[model samples]
Target chain A: MSSVHFDQVYKRYENGHEAMRHVTFQVNRGEFVFITGHSGAGKSTLLKLIMLMERPTRGQIFVDGKNLKSIGSRAMPYFRRSIGVVFQDHQLIPDRTVFDNIALPLIISGYPDKDIGRRVRAALDKVGLLKKENYYPIALSGGEQQRVGIARAVINKPTLLLADEPTGNLDPELSNEIMELFMRFNRAGVTVLIASHDRSLVQALNYRTLQLEHGSLIEEEVVA
Target chain B: MKMASPLDEKAAPSPLPTERHKSFGRGVRNMDVVWRDKINAYLRAHRYELVRSLRTLLSAPFSSVITILVIAIAIFLPIALVIIVNNIQLLGGNWDGRPKMTVYLQLDASENAILTAKQTVLALPGVESVNYIPADQALEEFKRHSGFVDILYELDENPLPAVLVVVPDKIGLSNDGSKVLLRQIETLAIVDSVQYDLGWVHRLNSFMALANRFIVVVTLLFSVGAILVVGNTVRLGIENRRREIIVGKLVGATHSFVRRPFLYLGVWYGLGGGLVAWLMAELGLFALSGPMVELAALYQANFQLQGFGLINSALMLVCSGLLGWLGAWLTVAHHLDEIEPL
Candidate 1:
């Protein structure tokens, strides 16, 4: 079954600016896809739509066969657990340690202490930040901070991963490093969807790519 | 760069698995096990959040102290007034548990008139018994005590009138009953005047009623003040941790989870304030104890300032805590929604 299905989704803000227009797409389970668009191309808004943070003005969204519109505010948190999200600004809580930041999702889902420790450590290792668990995000470099963000996004072992500009601050080398990490999780049966405009990396990686322009999907290409 | 395999392939345990999620429960996971784990998880989160919230307050000692001190003072004032009112009630009670009425007859009343008056008084309702002191006998007793026996012999006749000390029945000792009986006895033709100290009882009764109303109003005002004090404090706390709350909500924290720590912070505030209020009550009682003892000595009575009982202290803590919780809940419910991550 498809993990994400958007059917004729249209999103318009109250200010009359259209963020998405009649967009339709489907992501198969365990697929790695990148949403590439220039700034204001509605890439972030698309991720928000899938996350149900912003509702589409018209259209339906289904995540893992469950209709998002039917989910109430109380159920929104639980629904979000099936998906992981990383942000462009690396929204890691500055006051907390790297370990605590990653442990947040697990803690929200009420994971046992032992399970939290193992999973947090494994996720840190997955992002190659295992030794920096005790350090604060401020002490880490831009690449390292985004890695912490990634570690947190997947700590709960979500089936679907959604990242918006996950490497917007990183250099080409670190961007590739982050993209490769998403590939690893995808290979492990976790569907990954990253919204980034780094064309060199998007063209270089072997995944389905959806390119958006002027609030509409203009290109659908599969990289070899 | 080439894609690598996942770091660890071992699946992490699923905390809540659906009944038909057979693959997750393959070996050791079962319905009963899952239920137990969920319950355990809930308890652990509750415990951790409770302690963590308390630590948050303790970490900021000066501000916490001021907040708690304000709450304590609010609680203490009403309770102190309550204590003062209670002591006054006790003092008023000792004035006269059962006062008597005195009837003075005309000095020139004949023996037959005295006899008729005695018989008439005995027949009245609520008149338990009456003692008749004739004029000459009253003058003799007064002369012995007044050291005026020689002076009394110089007078033409005894100036003292026949006095009838009337004791009322138990029913007559109550508020309105005493007044009714006094009126009935005063209308007698032979009686010159009727006197009873029930006036003091009536005044004391009204004073007590007024005091009770004052206490209720005062307690209500102070309780609301305490709640607002706690509410404002929690509001500041929510503002300070606004970022943390946003992150928590973004990462899938339920509203309750975001609210738990603030609720606990309010509880700690209540706890400290309640205990401090109790402390202030004891201290206030202690400070006044010396004067109380001296006053009681002058009255030849043994009166001690009543300290708070154990149950009262416990109730104070619980009530203050509840107010604190309510205050936190109000603020959190009001502010947490505005904190959703964009």
Candidate 2:
């Protein structure tokens, strides 16, 4: 069964700007896929559609075997809990410590207090920032902040992980390290989908790739 | 990039918990455990949010104190008014609920005439009892209580007339019974005139009824003012945490989850205000109690100022807390929906 399925999805904004046009694709369960295009190529729009942050003008989206169209606003939060999303801006609360930032998802999910500490520590360890858990986001370096975002996104062990330009602000070395983190999580049986325009980085890690141009799915590369 | 493999046996445990129930009895038992865990988690979440909101309020002591003080002043006015009205009612109650009529005998009324008048008053309907004051006893009693003992005795003759105090029964005082009794007493030949002070009592009672309504009006107006104060404060709070709210929503937080802390903040403000209002009221009553006792003593009456008892104090706190909750709810319901991740 496919983890994400999009059939002839079309998205047009209120001002008549077309964001996604007749986009059709499927990412199978446990698949590691990349969606790459230039800026304004509907990369973010496609990801938003899957997250139900924006509804498609004409299409049906099914995430984890449930039709998103049938899910009302009241059910949106529960639906989002099964999927993890990372932003380019990191979106960390400045007043909170790294530990609190990552433990947010667990708290929202109402995880037991005893389990929260253990899970947060394990997530921080996975991102190699266990010692800096007490530091606020303002004190962290750019790359360190991005890793905190990744840790927070995966803290709940979501079945599907989505990252939008996760390394947009990092140097090439740090970008490669971030990419490696995604690869490790993908190998751990969690499906990973990254929307990035970093061509060389995408080429170095050969895997299934979906290329969008002019809001349409123009090319799809399948890995043997 | 060199790190331990996720598949290594020593790696951190996966976040997911595997399921194991297969038999019917085991499933039911596991369901019970799950329910217990859920309840615990729910309680823990509320406890954490409550503490966190308190910390947030303390972080900005100046603004919070100002907000709470505004609410307290709003609460204090009505409470003070109520106390004033209550004391007035108590002072008036000293006069008694039913009106009394005084029948004045002629200055030269003979002992036989005075006695006949007293007996006639007793025969009238609604005349509960009658006490006759002879002219000689009246003169002496007046000299003792008039505070002009020497001057009252210097008068050429006793100008004061003998008096009969008429108290009406409960049934006679109802409706026009007292009026009829007054007219009958005035018809006696030996009685010079009859005086009924029910007019003064009626005026006092109407004033009390008017003041009672004023308390309700003042309470309602101040309550709205207090609610708006809290609502505006919470509105600013929402603005300050706009980014946090967006991030929380992005991470799968429900609207209620985002709203919890703000609601608690409002409650804290209300409770603090209520506490301050109670203190202000108690202190005002305390400061006034000294003078009040002295004043009541001057009139030879025993009266004590009443303060809000335990039940009323608790009610004030609970009421203010609910007001705070309501204010936060209105602000959050309006503003939180306007905010969404772009």
Candidate 3:
């Protein structure tokens, strides 16, 4: 069964400008999918719809087969808990230590105190950041900060991970490293959907790709 | 899939559920998570923000002290005024047990006739004590006490009229019985006029009323000013941490999650300011009490100065808390939405 399904989805801003039109797609369980297009092609809007950050103007979205339209605001947080989101800007809280940042999801979920410490360490270790746990995000390199962001995303071991250009700010080598990290998470059975515009990176990965142009999904391909 | 090991089995390990079930369970779990860690971390991360806001306020010692002093001064003015009015009202000197009316006889009345009039006045209701001063005795006493003996010897006839001093038995002499008794005394044939300071009593009552209204208006104005001060402080805090709030929201922090610490900060400010205000008011009253007592002694009266009582202190504390909360609420509600992760 699909983990996320967008069926004839549409999103319009309050100014009455339609950002997305009849966008239909499905991402199956454990799938690694990429959404790529030019700026303003509704890539971020698509991620936002999936995150339920913005409600669609029309049509329906199903996350893990539960209709997004029916989810109340009180229940939205719970929906968000199962999904890990990484932004292009790597929005790490600069004031917090890397460890605290990674432990946030666990803390929000109210894992036992001991379990939080254990899982946070494990998540940081997985991102090769176990040694830098005490460092604040401000003191970290861009790649390290991005890794910390990734660590924070996966600490709760979410079933679906959404990366909105997870490596947008990194060099090619670091981007590949970040992609590899996503792959590792996918291998551990987490479904992954990444939104990126890097053509070379898209060609390098043999996965399902959805192309968008002016709010419409123009094409799809399996590079492999 | 590999079969579970003994340890794994003991841990209750199972295959990954279908995506639908996992997401549903996760949604429920996320609700629990957001409140648990994110809210708390937001508070911990923003501790410095609150302290810095307070420190910023305190950095200008002159302004800080002046601000607090201004509030205290405003609060003290009406309170002190009320205290003075209260003492002035007491100056009529324990009228409860000493309700007395003086009746003067006509100039042509004889001393025997005046004494008979006094006995009749004393028989009236609420007439507890009575003393009759014959015209001759009145004149002699005036000469002795008024320090006008040389002037008195130059007078050909005794000028003083016969006087009847009547004290009432009622605790409050303003009762209807006293009024009736006064009217009755006025009707006596030998009595020329009955003298009492009813106008002073009415003036004291009106002054007390005016003092109460003044306290209400002054308290309201000062409270509004306090809220404005606290609101401005919270506004600066929100501006200083604008970027941090954006980052938090982008990383999935909810609105309440971002707003909680500022609320607590406001509470702390109110609590602290309330304590300081109470202390300042009390100290003011303490310093003024000695002078108030000395002034009362000059009039040969015993009047005690009343400080901000426990009830007033409690009220100030509650007012401080409300002001702080209101200030923070206004600031956060106005600015938090403008700060978006986008």
Q: Which candidate wins on TM-score?
A: 2
iRMS of each prediction: 4.0, 6.0, 7.7
Ranked by lDDT, the better of candidates 1 and 3 is: 1
List runs of model 2 lying over 4 Å from the truth: B1-28, B104-181
Top candidate (DockQ): 2
Docking class of 1: acceptable
Q: What is the lDDT of residue B24 in candidate 1?
A: 41
CAPRI-style class, candidate 2: acceptable
2 or 3, greater by lDDT: 2
Q: Which runs of model 1 end up more than 4 angstroms from their true locations?
A: B1-35, B96-122, B126-180, B187-193
lDDT of 3 by residue, B1-342 (tens): 122222221111111223334434767676465444444544443553466446655665665555555544544555556556655556545564243577888999876787677778777877788888788888987865554677889999988888888877763275677678778888888889988555456666677778778877876777677767767767776887676676555444545556755665666566666777677667777898899889866655577876667887787778777777777787788877787655
Taking chain A by itself, what TM-score does each prediction score? 0.97, 0.98, 0.98
Task: Give the C-alpha lDDT of model 1.
Answer: 0.83
Tens digits of per-residue lDDT for model 2, A101-190: 999988887787678899999999999999999999999999999999999999988899999999898999999999999989998989
- Which has the better DockQ: candidate 1, or candidate 3? 1
lDDT, candidate 2, at B137: 88
lDDT of 3 by residue, A61-123 (tens): 998898988877545555666688887777776767898778765544434557778988998
- Model 3 residue runs over 4 Å out of place are A14-17, A103-118, B1-184, B190-193
